[model samples]
Target: MRMIEIEKEQENPKMNNLRNFYERALQEFGTSDEDLWLQYIQEELGPWGQPENCGKIHWRAMKFLEGQSAESFTSKHALFQSGRL
Candidate 1:
């Protein structure tokens, strides 16, 4: 069962495209807002209804996005406080 799941993920083009879209959204928005992230994802998925179709993928991607955005903000804040930025 696990092997089959792995194989399915490996061969999934939609998942790959979703990841690419996440990357593009991060680059374009550069903000930590979850709504913007969801908007971008919904736009990309486009009437496919992500919550029903790709819930796990969207959840994982959102977690990664939030973490990345938080880390970036913390780093920039630290740099600014230390007179680096």
Candidate 2:
């Protein structure tokens, strides 16, 4: 456990940078806009041939973005039904 802690401490700077990068990306792209979200993931994560797992992450992000769009649509529909919009 001590060794693991030491290793993590050594890697703390790198981890913090990565976390900040993702935080900025999420702030920019975590939205109901699917196109922007997809573009962000593709540019940040790169092509499908590299780090192949990124492709999966990209697909999952797209799916989640689609779900967000659906939810937005549902909310809009509800508003329309209630004659609120």
Candidate 3:
């Protein structure tokens, strides 16, 4: 079994591209074990799983969309942020 961590996330364009590639690969080559998929993503991206990475991506996107800086964003209050939740 694996454990996932929730932390202040950051977005990577490369990661998004990789996810799209993976989606296409899955459609073309068929599916594989989820654990294997996670392992592959971890190796290619980082320690966090895809969902967590995506969350980080969303956070960064939101920050950009709102014209906010990292210093202006509150990690602890993210869920309560008007446009974030």
lDDT of 1 by residue, 1-85 (tens): 2332353355443544554555565565535654444444454455433545445534544565567665654465456447685
lDDT, candidate 3, residue 12? Answer: 33
Write model 3 residue lDDT over 1-85, tens digit each, in one string.
Answer: 1111111133433544455555454344323233323333343445433544645544433433232333233332353334453
Model 1 score (lDDT): 0.49
Judging by lDDT, tell me the better candidate of 1 and 3: 1
lDDT of 1 at 67: 72
- lDDT, candidate 3, at 20: 57
- The global C-alpha lDDT for each of the candidates, from Candidate 1 onward, is 0.49, 0.46, 0.38
Per-residue accuracy of model 2 over 8-74 as CA lDDT, tens digit each:
3553334334434544555555545544433333434432223444456455454555566746644
User: How are the candidates ranked when ordered by lDDT, highest leading?
Assistant: 1, 2, 3
Clashing pairs in 3: none
Off by over 4 Å in 1: 1-22, 27-31, 44-53, 65-85
- Taking all chains together, each candidate's TM-score versus the true structure is 0.29, 0.31, 0.29
For model 2 the local lDDT of residue 31 reads: 49
> What is the overall TM-score of model 3 with all chains considered together?
0.29
Residue 49 miss distance in model 3 (angstroms): 6.2
Error of 1 at 74 (Å): 22
